[model samples]
Target: MEALQAVLKSNFRSFDRVAVIGGLVRDFAREGRTGFRSDVDLVIHDSKEEVALLAEKLRATPNRFGGYGYKSGPWKIDFWALETTWAKKHVPMQTLEDVLLGTFFDWDAVAYDLWERKLICHDDYLERLRTKTLEINLRPNPSPMGNLVRAIRRLVLWQLVPGERLMCFINEYLDEEALRYMQKKEEELFSYCVSSRWKTVEEAKFYLFQERGSDDLQLDLFQIKHQR
Candidate 1:
């Protein structure tokens, strides 16, 4: 938090409405969580010129979604213009509230307002954190793998068991052909993150079923319980 605050003070004095959001915010608010190797995610309600200026200052290149990454010490900071966030751009979400609330995971559905020095949380976000539970707040996400990987991280590392909604989301995610094709270069579904957990899609299936204590879920190619 000190690091992030220092970053804003030095680099973004002129910018406004640049809030720190997602993993970092949740972890910081909860006083930290183990294995929390999350990159800093920020969204600014500023002009494209401001975003570009920040990119130039950070010597970073914006991705196709108009977000950029900057390496500061051991931390990699990812910055996106508020409108550039997936839910905002693709879902045509027109408000900051929409962007903030439209998240795949309950815990990451929060933002720390930099100027106002307050936290903006989505529904049941605080309660979920208190209970260490995993849930899907938004189902229309672009990356199903994003939700799954994060859920597994919580299950294995953070000890957060999935709720009914999250389990349903995971089940739906299982049917996504792209889940088997997990080689995409996306924000949450990094190659190392997935590869370190499971070498093959079948291995992932086995582990998930083993965790959830059920093999009723089926695939045309897999017997579900026999994936191992």
Candidate 2:
């Protein structure tokens, strides 16, 4: 966090709302770990121009995600703008909590407000993190396929067991249709799981079923469907 604070002090002090969000905060809260190989995601409630200006000030390279990336030692910092187009409305986020609420998983719904120099999170975020649980955000209606893939990857990467309630929710809410939807991204999802060190599709399936405990869930469900 010292490195982040230093970078903000030098380059982004003028911005009204700038905070470190997502994986970095989650890891920091859990293990006091920082500078993980994954990109450090930052959220700013400002115009595109302001985001660009800060990137320029920091000499950060722009990326296709409408964000800028900077290398601070081992950390790759990615800053994103908040007033993005959604449902034809330019919804601008006002606080760190608003940004946290928009994330996919409960553990990801945590942030360290640089401006206020404090941590903020959704209710139960810390507890869920402590328990190594994964949850889908229904309010934003995040892509079911993407969340499922991410949940699997996180379970492998974090060596986490699924929470009982989370498993119940998956069994009750995630149906065959949801599994079928993910088939379209099977290859992509497969690569993600393997890259996270699952080694084989069956290994990934084991962890997935560890929570689901459903005979209906099968490895073939994730296999890519070849066009006949």
Candidate 3:
């Protein structure tokens, strides 16, 4: 974090606004464990023209997801304009006081203003964190798979219980067909992010099939396929 702070202080001082948002801020504020492997999302409130120049200045690559990917030592940082974020483009989620378009989860909605040396988060963010629960602030997202996988990841990593909305999201999107993609992503994510295993399809089903609304949610989701 010291390296990140130093780099930001030196490189981004000229910018009108530069803040660190997403998982890094959320994790750091709670545990101060912004270690070498930490990834960051930077919110640069600026025009795309200047942001592109800034990306070049930092020797960062423009990612396909409309962000600049820059590696500062062991930390990988993604720089983005506030207006151009996927959350901002798809949803009108004004769930954060500091950030206009909030992220999918309330836990991820926190941002740390580097210049101001302050943390900005939603009113319920800290409370939710303290309780170790996950809540969805934005839905009908561009990437539903990403959202579902993250919920599962958080459930394992943080031992955080999925809130009603979050469970509904998981139950809605995760079907037998979608489970294959979920497993693929889980294997990749587990290898890259952490070590976890579902072992079998049935095992994963046991964990994720907690019906949030209707009792027939699982039955409605799965269908028997008789084959020769």
Candidate 4:
């Protein structure tokens, strides 16, 4: 964190507003215990062009995700343009509070203001993190599949169990439409994992079905057939 802080301070200190947001902030709040594989997400309350200029200044190459990223030692730093509308309404994201409000999950609605050197988070953000609870900050109204998958993944990774409300919401709220959306997402993710070599079928199945243990006769038969 010190090294990353130094890099950001040196490069973006002149900027008026800057904050480290997303999973990195969550990991930071966990006292460096939660392991994050992705690069750090930094939000600058400025135009995309301005962020592109900053990326140039920092010698970072353009990333495919409409951001700038560069690898420094073991850490990967990414800069993202701050936007107002993350889910539904298009609210201008001028303040840190706006960003927190736009977050998909309560636990993720935490940020460390680099300029102020302080943490800004939702009222329940810390509580949710502490309790390891997955609560929705913004309603997954249009599509709930992504959020559902994320919640389940976090539950597995964090070893935290969801409350009854969350379970009821998942089981009751999902209709045919939501189930179709989830199936599509699963197919797309599976294709990406295969094509990008991100995860083999076995690896994907292992993580997705980790709780099922290794005693599945179907999986055993499939492996035996493939080995022949």
**Which 10 residues in a row give candidate 3 its minimum summed lDDT?**
219-228
Q: How many residue pairs collide in each prediction?
A: 0, 0, 0, 0
| Cα RMSD (angstroms) for every candidate in the order listed | 7.1, 7.7, 8.1, 7.9
Report the C-alpha displacement of residue 36, candidate 2, in angstroms.
5.2
Kindly list the per-residue Cα lDDT of model 3 for residues 190-219, writing each as its tens digit: 544321345554566466544343433333
lDDT of 4 by residue, 1-228 (tens): 577778788877867888888888887676574555447778787778788887887799976656788877777888777752343264457665677767666777888899788899856667777775666666544456666766655554455555555555556544555545555665666432111212343443334334443355356445445543
- On the 0 to 100 scale, the lDDT of residue 80 in model 4 is 75
Residue 106 deviation, candidate 1, in Å?
Answer: 1.5
Measured with C-alpha atoms, the lDDT of residue 162 in candidate 3 is 79
Candidate 1 per-residue lDDT over residues 1-228, each given as its tens digit: 467568767876677677777877777767765535648777878776778888997898776556998788777888887767877644554545555666777677788777888778756677778875677777777666756666765554454567788777766665436454444433344423333445665675566545443232233124322432
Where does candidate 4 have its weakest 10-residue lDDT segment? 191-200
Which sections of candidate 1 miss by over 4 Å? Answer: 1-3, 33-38, 89-95, 175-228
Backbone clashes (count) for model 4: 0
In candidate 2, what are the lDDT values of residues 1-228, reduced to their tens digit? 567567667776788877888777777787775534356788887888888887887898977656788887766888877764121132236655677656656676688888788888766767776765666543344344566656655654555666654455455544555444444455554533223324444554555657543243343234312210
User: Ranking by lDDT, best first?
Assistant: 3, 1, 4, 2
Q: Highest TM-score: which candidate?
A: 3
